[model samples]
Target: MKTFISSLLLLFSFNTFAAPKSELWSYWNVSNEKNATTISHQYWQQTLDKYLITRGEFTLFDYAHVTDADERTLNSYLRQMSRIDPREYKKSEQYAYWVNLYNALTVKLILMDYPIESITKLGGLFSFGPWDEEIITVAGKALTLNDIEHRILRPIWNDPRTHYAVNCASLGCPNLQPKAFTARNSDKLLDKAATEFINSDKGVLIKEENVQLSSIYDWFAIDFGSQQQLFEHLKKYRPELKPFKGDIRYDYNWKLNQQ
Candidate 1:
């Protein structure tokens, strides 16, 4: 009986709380055509420029060497972001705002608990990760990392490419770009991110008759629409990647993408 109960608890934590789907936080659905203000991400960019290192297929952040001044810069950027209501800006501008903020918050989270092997370790005995913890307050709402990614960005944007823009601070996730996202260059950034991730073995590796994909597709299957759609999405990035009738596999790395 104890064994069964333990198993149930594990399942409850991993299966129920781990993956959150895209549901529109309807309050953020509004956008302003009048607001053409370009929000500056220079502070966030400065941190990335100073600490992000491109290592082979993925990038690692040097969380250990972050100076006190730079950490203050990160926190200042987060504070500036949280004060503004995204609904007051155009969706294009809002996209970059939310993406940059999400990535910055994730990096800060890892820094708070530096020296950890995996983010899963921060989840304690029964939780999957720190994703559920309210890490930032934005527009008067206390939001979690999951809330930023799954709620605001995913639903408002309705673009699968969004998965590439927000970094999860994991080796298996998309590369954390050296430059912070911006309104003027966000679309281009998305396409570039998709291309880079798709071409890399971490995203898709075609071995003879089999196609191996990152678990992002499997986890966010709803975003990709279907298996056929996923294949099409892959081909969009890598034109040389011909469709195969072989088995498809999904895998991911949960280790902290730390330097």
Candidate 2:
């Protein structure tokens, strides 16, 4: 019947378009906590300083040039990260932890199987990316890169800037900062990262009369509130990018950000 067919079609549409619910992890305040220890990010800092090359607005890792010693250093850093208890840290420290962990794990994943063109090539069964795999364990909870970004950071902070903080190791992503994010400097680092990305050609392209934005704006549109909100967010960072009227399109480059 017409009614039953319509009902089934609507159900199918809903299922297809639905966004998965994210889990909210507990994040404690850091302000006024005098006893909170500074989480050491020296290892990540050293690796990034030695390997990351800044070209214009984006930074690329010297993946091909990495030596066995460098790989061992990265593994040791990840091991140190695994042993830390995130719950004992302040919100600022936890924020840095999750962002650093996500970025490090991504780099490690690529290093495990280097010489790949894109991250999509590392997809698992029934998944288009390596985001769903249990890549790390911290605070006794097994977490994937997706879990760290979505479940822990996004839900806990409800901040759009969080997206800019985690590098996806792709040309299209925000640059992986040359220095590791620290609790003492997280606020300044987040703002600087967002500003740098928004002003870059990779973030927003205005050619002739058309505006092409990074696919990040489209994929995580909800985090940015609405299209108007997204535009406002961009303008907030780069005020000169305003007062233009044009058609908009979204694009992304999945090629490895390697030197």
Report the error of model 1 at residue 51, Å.
0.4
Candidate 2 has an lDDT of 0.82
Question: 40-137 in candidate 2: lDDT tens per residue?
Answer: 88888889988999887779999998889988989999999999887777777888988888898999999998999977667553345587789888
Worst 10 residues of 1 by lDDT: 10-19
Regions of candidate 2 where Cα sits further than 4 Å from its true position: 1-22, 26-34, 243-245
Q: Which residue pairs collide in model 1, if any?
A: none
CA lDDT of each prediction against the hidden true structure: 0.87, 0.82
Model 1, backbone clash pairs (residues 3+ apart or across chains), number: 0
**What would the TM-score be for candidate 1 when compared with the true structure?**
0.93
* Alpha-carbon TM-score of each model against the true structure: 0.93, 0.87
Worst 10 contiguous positions by lDDT, candidate 2: 26-35
